[model samples]
Target: MNSPPHPPRQALPTHGTTLTPQAFRTLQAMALGGLLVLVLGWFYSPLRIWSNLLVVAYYLVTLALGGALFLALTYVTGAGWHVAFRRIPEAMASLVPKTGIAILVVLALRMNQYGWQLHAGAPEGTDAGTYWFKQLWLDPPFWMARAAIYVLLWSVLALSLVAFSRRQDRLNPQELPRAIGSMKWSVRLSALFLVVYSITFSLASVDWIMALEPMWFSTMWGVYQFAGMIQATLAAIVIVGLLLRRPGRLLYGIFRTDHLHDLGKLLLGFSCFWMYIWFSQFMLIWYTNIPEETSYYIARMHGPWGPVVLVSVLLNWIIPFFVLLPKPCKRSEHVMMKVAVVVLIGRWVDLTVMVFPSTVGKLPVLGIWEISGACCMIGIFGLLFFKALTKSAPAPKNDPYYGESLSYHCS
Candidate 1:
């Protein structure tokens, strides 16, 4: 017999169902495929291998660092606009372990490609500035340790948040304070993480990209990486969100237009933020016309590097500027998705700009290694994301604002 209807519940959840077998299969394929590609690049070829390695390595780091930051921000601000999407960030955070592993592998492989890391380049002048110029902080062991430390810090925070979120799902509402407290600590941990993440990323830029020239340096390089990390991570978030909310599904409204609107605004914010840093770094160096500083852009302007520089600027700033400048476009999920794709590609090209100068040296040998390695990173992203899908309830069961998020609509 049917039971009588009861009073309406305020926060009933819809994500108790676990992952499907198909999802598991997909995850396995991605992990296996990514490893295969990475191994192929590592062994088969020399040309563009480092390029591929850089692309994959940076993204893995990008996802983890960005994941940690997103979770921390949600905790810091306590915004309900994100309730529907929080699970995915948790999912992204869960992938930090794999990212950590990938990054470690990338550093190991760099021994062959990166000469500066092994020893300081011989200076060629009367002064240390003239001689040691680029090698100041671009040496090997230090670069190696810093990269390792970045992942280590990121993993700790990631695991912490994922653990607490899982606890929140299993326990009663009264347990929220503990979870929230854990979240608060995650934010504090992230604050310290950001400082190190920044220095480390700069050192990485110096280690991986700046070392290519072994002469060029940009203080804003860290900010540039941070901007791309935010942009790319958001793109990853949107892509995952789009898939999760596809057609009919239990955890729907996770990628609503309003959410897309907020995401678009974030994309726009980072676009502008990148430009500010880009211009600030460029103008000061340009104004002074410092032989040391101006050389970096000069190489990027003349040959094959020229196209990458132009393409990067156009895609990251120009296209997004026009497409996202209007309120209408930001509110439309379709438009933002398109914009996000380009923004992501532009960033990859920006990495190319960073890598090609030293590694490829205008040869443009984007050979098998590069293609395969990029595919590998993509595959890893897929695998980790898929695996994460199974680990958590699709939605938080009793978040206070679940209803608000469910009914959230664009004005």
Candidate 2:
């Protein structure tokens, strides 16, 4: 007969069992209700509400991309660092599709905001000529099609990877082929998804955010948003990994100091990456001072929004530079939690900076409209994310890497 199940263990400095199902449901309901209020406020302030959702969708896309990319890199490089910690992030990724629908709602609202949907009947000769000439590549139909394709690709890859792992869990270890097959599909799909993500996200950036100032264009915008994704996804994984370390879950013995170190290191590395991309974007614009790029900067640099810029840079890069740069700090669980909190805050600021220049246009309103909408998304994301995570065994038990992961170490 099988032995007794492991007792639910406490996490961190506290002493309590793993999150009970009832408690989990209660927390989820609270968060979901909060998000509902935010979303409902959209009716009164569509631009404000939709813009925030647009940004949220942007981050969600990155989370899934990060997950798919991480899984692929883990498999291809055979990196042992992530094996113990992979599934938690992998599970967070499953939230991508549910949020994808939310994104589509935001996308639909954009067409109405800018009249991008009514392209065919321009007012006259040279104006129409110039408009179509510049925007032929930025048509609304193309954006919708590409966005759908991106979501479909992401959904297939993410769900398939998770489902395949679940299938393997029910079988004997000798059914290693099933797990290997899943890994192989995951790796291949991840590569394709990355390419598609780059193209589609760059295009979507133009359609959704950058197009808010259609005259202003930046080639590095896509990569810039991508950097935010890395930063946010890194924090997300760290947070979830820490949470799942409670006993009676898959991560108890699996998530070791080495795993935490690797996560901390990723947080540090991505912090630098985000800074590099942001500077690269600004440098080209500042040096050339072209009318298009200059306009984008002018909107942000000259007024109430300038402080937002400083906050974005400071939160996204500066604080982390100090917190994560020290070797000792990065390895500590407390410091790592601090790092996650700051990065998450920074990402919110970064998204605000990216869009407020166009939509709010120097308007700095922190009223219920923005607050309620954001609270809703946050609550909903928290609800769906943990819900999706707990549904499975919390980790892939029969995964081929399970043995290596359970005893993961740096030596």
Candidate 3:
């Protein structure tokens, strides 16, 4: 027999969600305490502190950028399922400007650590590839200018897309035509943003991370970074979605398990993609057996760093792939949250593996310096995210597809 009609439900909340006073204080303490430790460590080991700062700052930037990329993608593809909890990604993207500034500061202080920056001149017998890279591409002023351009362009586009969404929220139902027009413009802007973002973000991966080991270059480095960004970003969305699903919360009745399942699917897909890119790069380099190319892997794959790499793979791919394979695991709040936490931690470790070996060249250590720096960044991220979350309605109400989003379900 067919089911009877259900009663009408209460409307979604109009206002944004706020952080409790105690929660605000906790994040404040975490940020400050971590800063104090980093400052104290700077006196004792400035290089270590700088390295950690660079890693964490880059991590922060990628997370925010990933959020923007997510928005641009969904908008361009006309994906409406995310409309119900779109504010989470918007809040996440709003951190781009703040994190952009953070990254510039770190780059100013630490760009010298890159091998290209330290080389006064290419030595005799330098290959044509290395020569051009050093002379044309690695010019410090040009590099900095490019970095500035990337940051400025991305900040404008990210914030503009966000502004467009917020503007749509003010329109009444009678203004349906205007909302549709706005979405059309959004589609155009998002398409432009993606074209720009793909090129810039790829170059960014080369300039920021790959350049650290100046002599070692992988053609797929950009793809590798992109995969990790999406994987971690999806994990972050899941965590935030679950948090907002708490009783009396903004997304209490809005963000559903079906949505979580979709996020989990993306998480699993990207984890596999990340591994594929990683293996492709590693396998190609190994097959070629080029000394310069092999040196990068040698540094990371041998000695103390070997175990770290193993753990990173396990956390980033092995664990998530298996855990999320089962359908129920993806739909369970506790299960999804734990996996998201694992992916986030794995992202940090994966970045650490990429950075530390190039800078410190020592065994991996999650000592006071690394731990505190992470605490500081995580705290800052939380504070900014919640602040952005409270700036508008917890869920977008004027998005043309908002109704469809509310009724979204998996078959």
Candidate 4:
């Protein structure tokens, strides 16, 4: 018996096309405007400004980290369907080290404000020695060192893979053996990065965000962060893919309904996964009725933050779940783009719920601080990502799996 015929192959454009000059100028203006707003907001409400900073920084890092994870998973699994769109994630991954440094700068500036130092007093009935031990473990210097290590590891892995991939573009397509040989190191490094990422990302979540409430603890917190990261990252990828598919764009003709459908499925699945993690964390804490853990919920469940929490759920899961269920929605580029936008905004709200209650407390205020901070970070991300995209072919022309990816289709 013979194998089934592949879908018709499509022509891919060569590299060198860049973002329009007008587009670059617009993005640069947004970046500067956002920075100005953040600066002005800082003078009015320092606490709110700082909280927004943390939220934005962490959100950017998750995006970059998600990109790395996407690449690693595809490489390890030998997935070929995404080879045409891999450059987007590669560019996103390259932003990781820069975002890490930005996060470190924020932490250094706000070192005195973290609540861990106050935990030295120990709770009633708790042993002082144990409390002090925990405090020592969370020492600011050690926390900073771990963050640097995570960034260093991610930077090395992402840059190495990109270097090898770009080098392939310059090689002769007939050198199939050399092409395969070039990708072998990426596979090996991806495997290693996956292991390192699982451990370090979890620890980083605990150290950076969870540590805000030094008294509260959740075993599921890391998973919660990871789930949200994946959802947001998928939404971002879909959005970028759509944008690049426009006429005269670098990625035109490369992405098809099948690729969009596959991406949509992942987006749908991860949206539910994020909700599951969210509910599990909430249920376990609510049922156990532990004051320490419950306090974390109490801060958000009451007052102004409560409504935002509900909206976050609806935007992130409920809407996307129902909307993407139909076959048509997933396959349609316009429909998926709308869903992706909602999920992206939902992700910002989710991150807000996580950081604001701990930092700003009962006074859940959203003003120039939140808006400016988000705009600034997003503007920076756009600038860096588009810059990276211009550095190489938007699609991997010489990839071993490029032909298969171009010809991929659903039954």
> Which prediction has the highest TM-score against the true structure?
3
State every prediction's TM-score relative to the real structure.
0.85, 0.86, 0.95, 0.94
> What is candidate 1's TM-score against the reference?
0.85
Alpha carbon deviation, residue 143, candidate 4 (Å): 1.6
The residue-by-residue lDDT of candidate 1 on 91-159, one tens digit each, is 888877777777678677765466553254454432355455434454566557766776677787678
Off by over 4 Å in 2: 1-30, 114-134, 247-250
Preferred candidate (lDDT higher): 2 or 4: 4
User: lDDT by residue for model 3 over 1-411, one digit each (tens)?
Assistant: 211222233555545355667988999988889989998998998888988898888888999999999999999999998988898889888899999899888888866666554366665444765577566786778888899999999999999989999999898879877988999888888999899999999998898889887767789999999999989899999988888877667777678777888899999999999999999999999999988678889999988999999998999999999999998888888899999999999999999999999888768778989999999988888888988888887777788888787776664
- Backbone clash total, candidate 2: 3
10 residues in a row with least lDDT, candidate 4: 1-10
- Model 2: lDDT of residue 44: 74
Segments of candidate 3 deviating more than 4 angstroms: 1-9, 116-118, 123-126
Q: Rate the local accuracy (lDDT) of all candidates.
A: 0.69, 0.69, 0.86, 0.84
Q: Could you tell me how far off, in angstroms, the CA of residue 367 lies in candidate 1 after the best superposition?
A: 4.2
Identify the leading candidate in terms of lDDT: 3
Worst 10 residues of 2 by lDDT: 1-10
